[model samples]
Target: MTVEFAGEYFPIQPGGRFVVGREGDLSIDDNLFLHRHFLEIAESGGLWWLANIGARLQATVTDATGGVQAWLAPGARLPLVFATTSVVFSAGPTTYEFTIHSSEPTFRETRREREVEGDSTIGEVPLTLSQKQLLLALAEPLLRRDGTGMSAIPSSADAAARLGWTVTRFNRKLDNVCDKFDRIGVPGMRGGAGGSATNRRARLVEHVIASRLVAKADLTLLDVGETDPADAE
Candidate 1:
């Protein structure tokens, strides 16, 4: 299906489908493109789910378990806010209900399904596959720059600019990266600023040292535990 949202065309499914834009038309793989788009939305802001096309038309997600997820898909021309769940959507017969689940979205397949006895529900909807992809893509560069000599955090805006993104988009990518890092227990993401920077630097040094030792492990002349004066010189 060819879906048009906010005057832009995006491929809805697999085929020789493309989304024509000012820069150029992009061929989209529905399974993969949504994930990438979600990241793009996140990079522009900490959250991308709010910007979904289904957020508008006063869409409400009600699962059989009575879980209510409400959001507004406001057009992209408006300013950002938390008041409404905004989505830029195509003019289609919007389906307020879906069989989608968060577990079926991305790499979160391990999510355990819960059954409410009477009605134990939360007001959260199933996140799109696009959103998941966005998160994964955001984690890559940030993770690369997190360990060893790359421990220093870079300006997300600068990185976004290099990728032809606006400043807003860059910040969103940084937020997604941080969230992923926290989930994976990479450390340093949630520490005090001054201490965190110092700790990361120290870890980087240790990592480099360990790597060097491993590289020269075959050379008996260079011992990892030795502190010989002759070897130092």
Candidate 2:
């Protein structure tokens, strides 16, 4: 197996364990949310698994269904069931993203093989200016702050206020943006009706940031001095 990080790839031998964290076999120092030994990947009984070793942090795992399957807290383990899986977590002041890949047979691999046989092409969807602005606001809470205090993820209302919109208006627009992404084949953007509102918002923010749909330069669009009359409460 092969593990890729920061444009570098490391080969993992079959049945050999690969440790990933700030001070593990794969040292990921870019994010402080990672522990000394945050995660371990290994093949056991002919199946690959990912285990979480962080004491406090939880890893969000998105399944083939494009919804969160589990929050892998300390002592938790999840099967690597897909050809590629996205893992996200927040710690301290930063959110981290990791992708796990497998060379063995998996649902995603089967789907890709079918696509290749059929010669299918996936197209990209363009974001409108308004959608771009909304994405920027949704991502603001995760961006680095300037003050000396401990970083905190902002509430939906706080993010709305930053964009000069009421929470209700912001949520309505957020739903619309999520629907747009869903129609465009973006994973993890669509939320189920059962989860807590806070979790849904967090998932949306994670998806937006992880997908690179929003960036620091896009924040400039949020600085528009005037608010839309329709967005005013």
Q: Return the clash pairs for model 2, or none.
A: none
Residues 148-182, candidate 2: write the lDDT tens digits: 11234456688778877777877887787777667
lDDT per model, in order? 0.30, 0.68
lDDT of 1: 0.30
Q: Which sections of candidate 1 miss by over 4 Å? A: 1-154, 195-233
lDDT of 2 at 179: 79
Query: lDDT at 76 for candidate 1?
Result: 31
Which candidate number maximizes lDDT?
2
Q: In candidate 2, where is summed lDDT lowest over 10 consecutive residues? A: 144-153
Clashes of 1: 18
